[model samples]
Structure formats: C-alpha cells, structure tokens
Target chain A: MTMSEAIEGRAALALLERARAVVDPPLRTALDTLPGPLRRIALYHFGWEDADGAPADGGAGKAVRPALVLAAARALGGDPLTAVPAAVAVELAHNFTLLHDDVIDRDPTRRHRPTAWTVFGVADAVIAGDALFALALRILAEDPHPASAAAAGRLSACVIELCGGQQADCAFEGRGPREVSLAECVEMAIAKTGALLGCSCALGALYAGAEPERIAALDTFGREAGLAFQLIDDLIGIWGDPARTGKPAGADLVAHKKSLPVVAALRSGTPAGAELARLYRTPLTGADVRRAADAVERAGGRDWAQLQAADRMAGAVQELSRAVPDPAAAGDLLDLAEFVTRRSR
Target chain B: MTMSEAIEGRAALALLERARAVVDPPLRTALDTLPGPLRRIALYHFGWEDADGAPADGGAGKAVRPALVLAAARALGGDPLTAVPAAVAVELAHNFTLLHDDVIDRDPTRRHRPTAWTVFGVADAVIAGDALFALALRILAEDPHPASAAAAGRLSACVIELCGGQQADCAFEGRGPREVSLAECVEMAIAKTGALLGCSCALGALYAGAEPERIAALDTFGREAGLAFQLIDDLIGIWGDPARTGKPAGADLVAHKKSLPVVAALRSGTPAGAELARLYRTPLTGADVRRAADAVERAGGRDWAQLQAADRMAGAVQELSRAVPDPAAAGDLLDLAEFVTRRSR
Candidate 1:
C-alpha cells in the first residue's frame, strides 16, 4: 500500500476499536430480555450470534460510521469514550435503514445469509426495524451528559431526512430511471446517507465542547465525505469484484438500480442510455447482468460513475480542508475520508 | 340520561372539537404530496376522508388522547392551545400502532370500514404508518420550542414499550386459553395502550412548564385513567349493544381477544373459564358472538371488568388530586378521565 493508504487504514482501524470498546454493555443490556426468536434474529443481525441466536461468528459489517464518529470526537478535542452513545446511535440508525432497505429493494441476501425479510418475513422485519429505530433514539436519551439532547436532536433530524430520501429513492424505482443531475443526485445521497454521518461528526464535536460554528464545520466535513463514500459505493456495486463486494460483479446493473452511475449514464442519454433503456425493459438474469455491465461500460456508464466518484472524493477533501484548517486536529479524520472513499469492499 | 352519561357525552364532543382544530393541518400537509392511492387510504384511516379521499364529515372518532392533553394543560393552569403539537403527537402515535396492528392481526375492518390494509395493501399501509410516525416526531421538532427533544424522547421510549407489549399480545394469541390475572392484563394494556395516553398528559404539562414532579404525577394519573378506559373498552367490545359500541357487540369475544374482562374471568378458572375455553375452541360467528356474550355476562366477566374500571378511575382521580391540588385545575380534566372510562363509543 502507498503511504497515504497505510495511514488511512490504521486510522480507520483504530477509530473502530475505540467505538467497539465503548458500546457493548449499555446497548447489549437493552436487548437482554427479548423472547428467543426476536433475541436470536436481532443478535444475528447485530453480528453477535448465529441466525438461530446461537453463539457464532458470521456476517459482521465494518463499523465505519461509528469509526467516523469517534475520530470526529477526537479531532474536536474530546475523549472519544464520552461520545459513545452518539456513536452507537448513528451506527444503530445506519443498520436500521439497512434492514428496511433490504426489504424495500427485494434483496434476499445480506452478509451472505438471507436478508431479515427472507428470514423474518416483511411483517416481522418492519417491526424489528421499528424496534431498532426506537432503540437508536433511546440510546441517545441514555446519555446523561449535558450535550445529550442536542446530540439526540441532531440525530433525530438527520433520520427524518434519511426516511424522506429513502422514500424518494423508492419512488424513483417505479417511475423509471431517474435522470438526476450530478448535483441533485449528490444532494439526495447527502440526505439518504450523509445526514447521519454528518450528525455523527457534529455530535462528537458537541460532546467535545466545540463551538457552534466549528461543530457546523465538522458536520459539513462529514457530509461531503459521506457523499464521496456513497458515490464510491455506487461504483463498487456495479464494477467491484465478487470477493470484495460479496455479490456478483455488476449487481447494480442486474437490479437496474437507479444508482448514481446508472443515472449519470441515463442522463448521458447516448448509446449507453439506449442500451440501458433496452435492458430496463426486460427482466434481467445473470447473463443479462453481464450484458448490462458491458453495455454500460461501452456506453460509458461505468466510466462516468467512476469519474463522478473521484470528483466527489476531491470535493470532500476540499470541504474537509476548509472545515478543519488545523491539520493537527484534522489529520486522522482526513485519513478516514480517504480510506472510506477508496475502499473496494 | 344519568348525570355521568351527560358528562361523558359533553366530553366526547369536546374531544372531537379539540382534535380537529389541532390535528388537521399537520396531517393534511404531510399527506398532500403522496400518491393518490396512498393519500386516500391514509386519510380515510385518519378519519379525514372516505376511502376515496373525497371531502366528508362524521367518520372521526373521539380524539380522547389529544383531549386528555388539552385538558391536562388547562387543568395545570396553562393554555390548551399551546399543547396542540403534543396532542397531535399522541394521536399520530395511536394511529401508527393501529395501522401496524391491523397488518399484524390481518384484520379486514376497522370502524365499520375496510381496514387500511384492505384498501392500500399491507406494504402501503406500513409505509403510510411510517410516514405518520415520522410526522409525529417531526411535529415535535418543528415546534421551535425548548421541550422538543424531551417530548420526542418520551414518545420514542413509549413506542418501544408499545411494540414489546404488542409482540407479547400477538404471541399470547397462539397459546391456548389459560388463566391470566386482571392485574397482568392491565399491565399489558398500560404498556400497550396507556403509554401514549400518559405521554399526552405529560407532554401537555411539559409544554406548560409544569414542575417535573407534577408532570410525573400527571403521567401516572393519565396512565391509571387509561387503564380504566381500556377496561371499559373491553366491556363494550364483549357485552354492550352494537348500536352503542358501533362495532358488533362481543367483537373481542368473537376474535378471542385477551381483553381485561376476558383475562379476569380466565383467572377465576371457575365455570366461566371452562365455558370460555369451550367457546374459544370453536370459531366465532355472528350468532356465536351472541352466545359468547351471554356466557361472558353469566361468568361475571362484565362485572369484573367494570369493578376493575371503577377502582382505576378512583386511583386516577387520587393521582390527579395529588398532582394538581387545586380543585379549579381539576375541573374538566376529571370529567375527561370519567368520560374515557364511561363512553360506549
């Protein structure tokens, strides 16, 4: 790895470690009394148990959001440990969306096992998602420190945006491929994904006693970084290898998802748009995924998506630079931004 | 009419007046942009329209929770108008549960109309309920006041309890009829139903700047009153005339619901319990409902539930007396509690 990549990896890992150490007791204690089926399913989704609720290791995702929270706290001159509840809140909210998104997207697999919908049914999954949504807010309430309500308020506001953005995203599906402008798509992604990330950062700064203006700056930084990460995610969904993505290459193409790149390609409205239009007309199978990917690539969909992702990453870096002029306070967080935007998995 | 009946009638009318004045704007604004089908079904469910979203009147139920909020605020020497958002919050939360509950129970009708699930499909209903739920929290956020987070937190915490109670209630349905105490059933109802009611009162006090201790006491009062009200509801569901109760008499008995009266009778485990078990073993029809009602009355379920309601009403009065202290503040608020426990519809 290059020098910057090595630094980014270490920062990401270190931030995650701190978040892990701080979260278990209070969060776990909240789930201790559930019935076996709910307990097991929830635990498995939490990556703490097998699908049946038995103790086992499987399908755990990287705690990237929480890492950003902790790193942001430290960057704002606060001890990361004190911001635990806020960190946990963002992570839980992230997972809450994932649970519902899987059901909405009709994705059967997540982390290699069946999605919560496949395993628990949509009814139970919706209930479980609501449960987690409540849990996230409750976790915010548990913070006894003075900054708690502000942190909770910010998180709650961001989640409202998340729901709105998700609703818009789902609405996009039935109406045909959304020809969202590059700017508009980025803004929607900011709501869909960046709002929580930025809240995490702002929450950390609030706990660290950062001034209001600086806290707002940290929020701005996290927002851009979050958008950059989502753009990169869109690219990976379409082109990343199976080993890294945990799905067939070009899964986005197969699903005909109105991902940023696909939207970009549709907006490009060239041979690529015509090919995408044709593919969109029929049911896509495994072979069709190959053709869709090839068509998008030849039609320049893949290239546009990648270039857009890189541009977002650059924009994020510029935003971060303005937000944290003190390189000393910003170094580690900047590293995190780079790592997230560059990740293959 | 008896003196008690007149008071209840007046209170019910007052509740509707207070509810429509506060609930309409926020509910309509949030739903204005949704697709026609979604908006229509949701509006119908909220009693804002017929199933077709056309303008209508007279379908709305008594807005008991919001009335409790306004009455509590007025009783506490505060402006009832100031508590409007809290009132809306409680009502929205109630509807949120109803939408989900109908889906979980697979019930086909509510308030003599096809249920939201029947009209919109379960998926749309779920999304619509979420839309309402988010709107509840958003209303709190939009208040431009200091207590938004605290109010949201209380509502959120109560939602968690409500979900757990619902899960337990659903789980109990499959377990064969067995002895369950009136007290235990009350606890379930409180968790399942009282949380929102209690929140209504507490939120009003909070908005009015009532002392924290007073707020806690008012919450207790509202909860006890809620229990009394639920017991009364259970009575209407199983024994009252269909003309008075709106739905067919003995509806809960037909559904084999574990209402307060049913639980009380079952715990007796005497002749009533045995008769209940036999009746429960057979699928209930319209004629069967009449039979079950007779057995329920003969088994003393109606009286047991009534006596329980009397005790809870007294307890709630005692709690409110302790909190408000001033007889003047207790004026219509006491009438509200009595109305909640005595109303047939």
Candidate 2:
C-alpha cells in the first residue's frame, strides 16, 4: 500500500480504538443486566468471556459501526462524548445481528472464534441475540438526549430493513442459481449490511442535533460506504488468502452464496455465466469451486464488482461532502470508509 | 357458572373485541410496511392470511394483552383511544415472543393452525419475529406521548427478562426431570409469561400519564394475573378435555414438559413424585401419560397449582385496587383477568 493509504488505515484504526474505549464500558454494563445464561452467551458472543464464563482475550469485531457513529457526530461539530451511548447502542445492534446471522447461516466461526451458537447452542444464541437487541433499544430509550427517540425510531426501522434483507438472502439461497438478479442481490446487501451503517451515522447526526437534511446526507454517505465495503468483502470472500481471511479461497463459491458479484456473474448472460451457473447447480467439489471462481472472473464479475465498489465510494464521498463541507471535518469518516473498502480481507 | 361469573366473561369478551377493533388497524398498517416475505409470514402468524397468502379467518389471538393495555389506560382515567398505539405495540411484542417461542420449542401449531416456523420455516419465522419486535419499538419511538420513552424502556427491559425466561425454560428441558426446581420453574413462568403482560399494563399506565408508583402497581397487577393464567394453562395442558384444548389429555405429561405443575410434582418428595419422575424418564405411551398425570395429582401438583392460581388472582386484585381504587373503574381489568384464569382450555 502507498504511504497515504497506510496513514489512512492507521488513522481509521485509531478512531476505532477510540470508539471501543468509550463504548465498551457502557456496552458491558448493558449486557451485564442480562440474566445469567443469557449474559454468559452475550459475553461470549462479544468476546469478553469464554463459553465457560471465564474472561477471554478474544477480540470483538473492529467496531467500524461505532467509529462511524462517533466520526459522523464529530464531523457535524458535535461532541463525540455526548454520542457515546449511541455508539454503544450501534455496536450492540451490530453484534446482535452477527449472533443471529451466524445461527441462520450456520456459520461455525466469527472473529476468529467459534460462533456463539456453536459454543452455546442455537436456542441460547438466538435468545441472547434477542436480549442484545432489546438492550440496544433500552439504551436509547433510557438515554436523556433530546434526539434519543428519533434515533431509536430510525434504528428500529433500520433493523426491520435488516431483517428483510437477511430474509431475502436466505430465500435466495433456496432458489435456482440464476434465479436471483443482480439488482435484487444489491438491494439485499444494502438492507442487510448498509442499513445499520446508515443508521449508525444517522444516529450520530441525530445526537449532533444536525438538521434533518444533514442527517439524511450522513445516512446516504454511510450507506454508500457500507455498500462499497460489502462489495470489497465479497470480493475477498472469493479471492483473499486463507491466512488473511481465515477461510478457504472461493468460500462463497463453494457454498454457492448468491453474493453481489456472483449474482452479477450469473446474470451476465455470457457463456462464462452459463458455465458458472452449471457449476453452481450441484454441491461443488474443490476443482469445481476453482472453476466457478475462474468463470466468475471470466464473466467480468470481478471487474464489475471492483468498479461498483469504486463508484459507491465516489457516491459516499459526495454524500459526505454534502453533510460536512470541510474536507478536514470529513477526514476521519473518509479514512474509516476507505479503510473498510481497502482491507485485503 | 354463577350469574356474576357469566356477566364478567361476556364483559371481558366485549372488552377484547373492542381492543381488537382499535388495535388491529394500526397493527396491520405497521405490518404492511414489512417487505414481502417477512410480511407474508407475519400476516400468516397473526391469522390474517393463510400460508398461501390468501386472506383467511384463522383468527389472531384473543388480543388479551392489548385488552389489558386499553383497560389499564381507561382505569387510570386516560383516554383509551389515545393509547391505541401502545396497545398495538404490546400485541406485536406478544406475537413476536410467540413466534420465537414456537421455533425454540419446535411446536407445530398455534391458535389452532400450523405455527409460523412450522409453516414458513424456522429462518423465516425467526426473521419475522425480529422484525415484529423492531416494529413494536418503532411504534413507541414514533409516538408523541410524553411517556413514550419510558414505555419503550420498560418494554425493552421486559423483553430481556422474557428472553432470560425462555433461555431458562430451554435449559430446564435439557436437564433431568428432577433437576429443575419448582421455584426455578415459577421464575421462568413469570419471566416468560408474566413480564410481557406486566409490560402491557405498564405501557398503558405510561400512556395514561400515571405516576411511576401507579405504573408499578399496574405492572404487578398484570404480572400476578399472568402467573395465575399460566398456572391454569399448565393445568389445562395436563387435564383439560382434548375437545376444548385441541390436544390430547395429559399433553404436557406426554411431552414431559417442565411446566410449573410438573416441577412442583417432581419436587414433592413423595412416592408419587418418584413414580412421575420414572414415567418422565422414557417417552410416555398413552397409558403412561395418564399414569403420569395421576402421579402428579397424587403428589399434590394439581392442588398446588390450583391454589397458586387462586392466590395469584387475589394478589392481582390487590395490586389492581392499588392502581385503581374504584371498583367500577377497575371492573374491565378484573373481568379480563378472571376470564383468563377461569378459562377451561
């Protein structure tokens, strides 16, 4: 990576670390209110405790969403400290989705550890997820901030959209290989991934007491950035090194995941697209998985996804500019956005 | 039945019908905002549509929780009409729990039809339930009432307790028959069933602009009534007529459900309790279920549950009187509470 890219990455990491510093205490306090079994499961899911209820050093996620919340608030000239509860709520909400999504996807691992359901069982994981979500909302509800109610409404609405997105993702998995369209997949990705990010930013704007239009702009900025991040993440799912991503190469291909690029390839209507569809029709062998990846690349899915990611980043920057006119003010948000989209893993 | 009992039941039915009328429109409006698949599943779960998406008369639940909300509001000299949103929210939250609980328990049916999870698949049911909860919170967050924030906080906290209760219930199911104590079972019942009912009443009290103490009293009133209802329901699970309950007699016994009565019987320390434990060790045949039911009765489970139900009802009345001193104003709430506990099925 270039020097500037390295600087941006480090800056983003610092922002994330700062967010974690402020958010973790309140997040832990909220989670501690859960009754015994649910509390243990939640703590385990958050990497704060082991399955046996002992403390663990396993890291939670990168806190990207919480960083966005704080950055958006600061970009709008609001006190980041005042928005700490919103940041904590956003992180809690994001983790709640992770727990449920892991169960729904039957994903065995997350954040380099066994997923909560794998450790505690699906029932406990699901209930713990529900409790986390409730706790997230409770934080907002109990917050004395003037913007708390609006933030809660927006966040809750975004959660519904997130649910819809996940439901669509699951539904697409049961359909034929070519059945899911590129447009549908994009919508699902936005709902599943972008909505919460957008809400995080919007919540920051709300806490900042920004105008409605500014909040909307920040929401759009975060959403576009989130889409860019997802596109790149999906690309990594197909091509990243196992050492970097902690997964086999072309893991999405092996699972026949109708990710954005895969759907783009399937809908390309080229001969390579047809070949990819044929490979996707059956449980893929390792060789077939390699062929599927090659076919996706040959069908121009990789190029298309890369272009889409860049275009989304451009759109996100434009939205951020609208929300925060000064480049210096928008620097942290941009850094975080670029860091997410540029990550090798 | 005596003359006064018959009148009270009819009055409660009328109150429920009135609540359904006011609450259904907003509930439907809120649900209609859901995307296609989640909306279809939720509609089916609420008995507003068939699995095929056709309109059906399957009948949503009795609107008992919503009735409690409206009744509590009116009892506090508030306009019940103004509390319609709170009523809808309580109903949505109640159904959300039902959807998740059905999946967790793997129950095949609800409201005399296939449960949402059984009909729509577990993933869809789970997503639909999550959306319902988000929608419930969204309603409160959007409400302009002075008490909306407190109501939201109370509801969210109650949901956490409900999750804890459900987690405990599932854990108990995995243990030996004699391992779950009566106190633990009772606590689970309160958390699972009583909490939501209490929240319903508390929400109404909030919307009514009642003082915190009054709200607490209404919550306690609903919780006590809810426990009484659970005890009676558990008893019905074992001994009610199949024609009335739409299940085989001794259904809980056959399933070895660690319901309140079963736990009480298991903890009785009598020969009959030991016999019941032995019967619970293996899958029960028809005669075995009957024998288990008789064993529980001989171990004093039935009488214990019956007495507990009565005592809970008395406690409920005491709390209701504290919240609403005038008997005339409290009549609707009392009638509804009595109707629930007095139901044969």
**What is the C-alpha lDDT profile of model 1 across A217-299, one tens digit per residue?**
77887787788788788878887889977778888777778787777777776886778778877888878887777776777
The TM-scores, one per candidate, come to 0.89, 0.97
Residue pairs clashing in model 1 are none
The DockQ assigned to candidate 1 is 0.36
Tens digits of per-residue lDDT, candidate 1, B217-288, equal: 888888888888888888878767888777776788878898877776666667866787788888999777
lDDT for model 2 comes to: 0.92
Tens digits of lDDT, candidate 2, B1-345: 999899889999999999999899899999999999999999999999998999997499899999999999999999998889889988888899999999988988888899998888889899999999999999999999888899899999999999999999999989999999898999999999899889989888888999999999999998998899999999999999999988788888888898888888999999999999999999998788889999999999999999999999999999999999999999998998898888876
Alpha-carbon deviation at B53 in model 1, angstroms = 6.9
Badly placed stretches (over 4 Å) of model 1 are: A1-3, A32-41, A50-60, A114-121, A142-144, A177-188, A211-213, B22-61, B107-124, B138-149, B179-184
